[model samples]
Target: MNVTIIGGGAWGTTLAQALTDNSHSVLIRDINEAFVEKINKRHIHPFFDIVIPTSIKATTDLDEALDFSEIIVLCVPTKAMRSVLVDINSKLTSKKLFINVSKGIEPETSKRVSEIVNEVIKKKYFGGYVVLSGPSHAEELILRKATALVAASVLKKNAKDVQELFANEKYLRVYTSDDVIGVETGGAIKNAIAIVSGVAFGLGLGENARAMLITRGIKEIVSIVVALGGKMETAYGLSGIGDLIVTASSMNSRNYQCGLRIGKGMGVEEAVGSLTQSVEGIRAIVAGYEIGKKYNLDLPIISAAYKVVNGQCSAKEALTSLLGRSLKEERYW
Candidate 1:
């Protein structure tokens, strides 16, 4: 399969490398001319330390990328997803399979990446859509570490195709799910919970607090998933609890790092600015808070995370607020 990846970030570059190593032709498109040139000449990303496969090509032209491949993998950030899709729509001459790897709700409209893609692309030009998400990180993935992911689509065949595209028995495993909503919801909101876990770690809170936050966090996630019409059981799968555990516990997670800085008394802005990569949890937490409000759901941990991330309350205050919530009979539903 000829694949074109639309972003030059760590994840995008990693995917390009993986696909190329699998003997699939890949073209990476990025706005940065220097980054493109670097990849083409050196097979290395300026930001991430991973060595790209020599077979992969890089381009600054979106039209060229769209023309080069049957499958387009979108790896841009959530905030850039709409604009990038709109650009792709303008250049699209025919139907193409779109696999979105970005995870997050649009802050302004609370739309998922697939929703934004559908809104931007013309109906006649639509081929298929698939979301690739789970606990896997680009850093680990590029090193050929074992990773599992879920490829979800309304159409099961499309999901299976995606699974075949990326799955390698040695390092990568892909599972298919019909519940796109469940998969996407798990992938997006887990970042917010990861930030809270980082905060707990930063505050010198030990295993007990981390366990508490993770347990309650999954409940918050499942509640939103159910409200959104996704299956409750999906929350326990690779895209849900699996993702939450890896993201919240690992220092490799940018969201967790952001929270760690905040927990150590650094300002949110400072913490965010210090990172070389985007901290998606900061944005996802706001969207999660909005979703909780829209659904009239009681998400104490999510609420606290939003408050802390927005600087509306200190981490300690947020923790206290969470602890002070009125106790009810414990329920997992």
Candidate 2:
């Protein structure tokens, strides 16, 4: 299979390498000429420590990459999803499978990645859309570490096809599901919860506090997922609880690191500015807050995260307020 990855960031480059290892031809498209040139010349991503496979090709031309593959993998951040999809849609002359690996809701419209794709790409030209998400991170995957991810689509066949496309028994495993909403919702909102977990860690709140945050965070995620018409069971699967566990516990998560900085007394702007990579949770918290408001859902942790990250409240204040909320029976459903 030929695959065109529409981003040159760490995740995109990492996927290209993985595809090439699976004997699939991969082409990477990026707007940065310098980055593309460096990858084509050195087989090494400028930002990450991983080396790109020699078989993979990098280019700045969208048409050339689009024309070379039957499957287009989007690895760009959620913020860039709209423009990237528009560009791809303009060049698309026929239907092709699209696999979105980015996780987040659109800040302005609060739409998921699939909704943006559907809006940009006409239905007649639509082939299939699948969201590849879960606990897997680029840093671990690039080193051929064992990892698993979920491929979700409204159509089960589409999800299965994607599962087969990237499945590698040794290093990577792919699971298929028809719950696109659940998968995407889990992937997008977990980042916000992970920030709360990081704040706990930064405050030296101990393992119990971190555990409490993780458990309650899943409840918040499930409530929102169910409210948005997704399966509750999906929230317990790889993309939900699985992803939350890994991201909240690891330093590799940019969202967690951002929250860590905030808990250590740095302002949100200063912490965000200090990072070289995008902290997706910063955007996710705002989106989650909006979703909670629109749905009339109770999401204390997400709300607190939004307030802290936006500088409307300090982390300590937010934590105090959260603990002071009215007591109620724990509900898993």
- Go through the candidates in order and give each one's C-alpha lDDT: 0.89, 0.88
Q: Give the Å error, residue 184, model 2.
A: 0.4
The alpha-carbon RMSD values of the candidates against the true structure, listed in the order shown, are 1.2, 1.2
**lDDT by residue (tens digit), candidate 2, 1-333:** 889999878788888877888899989998989879878998887578557787878999999998998799998889988998998888888888889999898877778998999999978778889999999888888888999999999999999998888989789899999999999989999999998898888877888998999999999999988988889999999999999999998889888898888888888888888988777887888988999999999899999888887778889999999999999998877
**TM-score, predicted candidate 1 vs. hidden true structure:** 0.97
What's the TM-score of every candidate structure?
A: 0.97, 0.97
- Clashes (backbone N, CA, C under 3 Å), per candidate, total 0, 0
lDDT of 2 at 21: 80
Question: What does the lDDT read for residue 247 in candidate 1?
Answer: 93
Tens-place lDDT per residue, model 1, 1-333, is 899999988888888877876779999999988889889998886467567788889899999999998799999889888899999999999889999998788878878888898899998888999999999888888888999999999999999999999988789889999999999888899999999999988988988999999999999999988888889888889988999999999989998999999899999899989998878888888888999999999899998888887778999999888889888999997
Q: List the residue pairs that clash in candidate 2.
A: none
- Clashes counted in candidate 2 amount to 0
Model 2 alpha-carbon miss at residue 283, Å: 1.1
